[model samples]
Target: MNLMETIHLHKNDFSKTERKVYDYIVQNPTAIETATITKIAELCQVSTSGILRFCQVLGYKGYKDFRFDMLHYLHQEHVEVNSENLFDELTSKYLSVIRQFNNIDQNKLNQLIKQIKNTKNIYVIGVHYSSLPAKHLVLGLQDLGINTYFAYDYMQASHLYNTIHEDDLLIYFSIEGNQNNVSRFFDLTNASKNTYMITLNPKPKLLIENTLILPGYTLSKQSIVDLQSIVVIFVELLLNMFHNTLKED
Candidate 1:
């Protein structure tokens, strides 16, 4: 279940103080995107500790982690509409997503970026709808003069896989992270030390070695619109970082 569904499923299990916090969260999710624990407590008429406990009840490490999840959730929900006058709402949600991006561990992202940059060639694989981001990533990297290829067809993907070596990089994108094609791509890339995988599947068991796990958001039951927005933003930021590092060097 996604974060929103999980919260709703266990709503009745919350204590009175927790219920107040929960209600506040449900009502002002966007506000919570940038809200402090003190602010949340004040808004909910509870103590800061009570807010922490509320987050712990939801399986987060603490209030900060809970806020991150909430921000992701709010962004996922608000970014899909085609409203004209909703620019303010969209801007707020966009800023919230960027804030989450900013909070990503710099050391980890720098390591991933270095891995990508140092590789002789990069192959990005994604199947079905997940292929959207893979293609975007390749184009973004290419614009920065990186050697990148995006494989969408099975035959081309297979050919690309056969050519991959230790000096090359493989970046896989899978929303569910369980598709047969995605698994096969991982198996092929597993022999190469430079392989990395990104997916929305949050299950720990689904993670593979050498993967840089990024959280994915689901906007609708039938579409991965939110995940697409996330992938675009992430790839753009990564490309900018890569370019900036090159200039610095």
Candidate 2:
């Protein structure tokens, strides 16, 4: 059983404090990657000793060992899962993804929102499965009255690139940061100072002014589903901000 399933099966065994720690751990795996016991306890509004007990329940010697094992479990799970049980996997995956997002620099997301509002047009590019997120982002932006366009195919992307202006915002979505066609689109969009990209990996060969790194292994097959879910959450958050921003206008 995966970490999530294990948690579900043994949830009744956890004390209230341990349950809080468990929920926080399952929800925020990325945070667990760099978090201290103190930090986790503070975030969960529990005591440090409570967190140590939570770790012990998971069969780890201590918090450090538990975190190490959790990371390894997530890494292994990412590689082994296929599309068959992807939905169930995502249940746990999204909890972790949202935790990562919660840890992101809100100031940076605010800056990106400012850039979006100032841009003349927004172009979103993705190919194949990655296009699923691109379309979702475009719809969210459009619903908020932002002018946005998305390209699902290389040919259409090239045509759209021709109309892109220096003031336009370019957002690229790809699970793997290195797709030939998506790379080409990045190269074309590089001429625009407003270009931005979102991918599982923040590091990309093609230069962009801004990048949103969602934690997960891009090379993993399960990563795409996880990334797509993250994108949906991001869109919802962006839309909320857009609505608030418009109200002030």
Candidate 3:
């Protein structure tokens, strides 16, 4: 989470004295990014130690870590997910999906952007309904100046998976999370910490920490119906943040 999100999430956890500091920071987000702890303490009418305690209450070791995340919050684009005046079930469902993606831990989104920025090579794989979303992500990465490899064929997936190094990043865009076939399962057999999966389900039998879940309706792993259009929107959302980060740089 970014500094603002962390404070908002834990606002009530702060002591009464700390709330003064909270109110100041909330009212002056941009100013807080540039202010030192002592200056913030003066502005909030609290002692320097009180400001230190306030940062610690928000899980920061000190003011420097807090300022760094606050600067990130200042530089990034603010997202507004609009889903008003909708009556249809499909629209309602899609709005819910978008809100879920919007509410994903922002720190992870920031870290995912960093992972893309730092990785030397990225191999993205998908199949069935997920092929287009995978390609969409690959193209987005390529647009951001990352050397990304795209794979939809089983042989290509296998080749990428086998040749993937510890430094290389592997991305999977799967609607069902788990594989629908033995060949695909074989291709994903070596998913590591460097692998990231964006999917509707987390039952992929891989490292859960790297899995980014989304909301969608599905009947089976190989169901005929595809809800991957929402996946495209999700990819676009991510690409927007990545593109914004690029502009910030």
Task: List per-prediction Cα lDDT, in the order shown.
Answer: 0.69, 0.71, 0.71
lDDT rank order: 3, 2, 1
Clash total of candidate 3: 0
Indicate the residue-level lDDT of 2 in model 1.
77
lDDT of 1 by residue, 187-209 (tens): 54344457666665444344556
Off by over 4 Å in 3: 1-87, 180-190, 205-208, 218-224
Please report the candidate that would top TM-score against the real structure: 2
lDDT of 2 by residue, 10-93 (tens): 678889999998787666666765456777788889999999888777777898887767666666664456888877776765
TM-score (all chains, Cα) for each model: 0.62, 0.64, 0.58
The local distance difference test score of model 2 is 0.71
RMSD of 3: 11.8
TM-score of 1: 0.62
Candidate 1 local lDDT, residue 247? 90
RMSD in Å for all candidates:
7.2, 6.2, 11.8
The segments of candidate 2 whose C-alpha lies over 4 angstroms from its true place after superposition are 1-28, 32-73, 77-90, 184-191, 202-207, 218-226
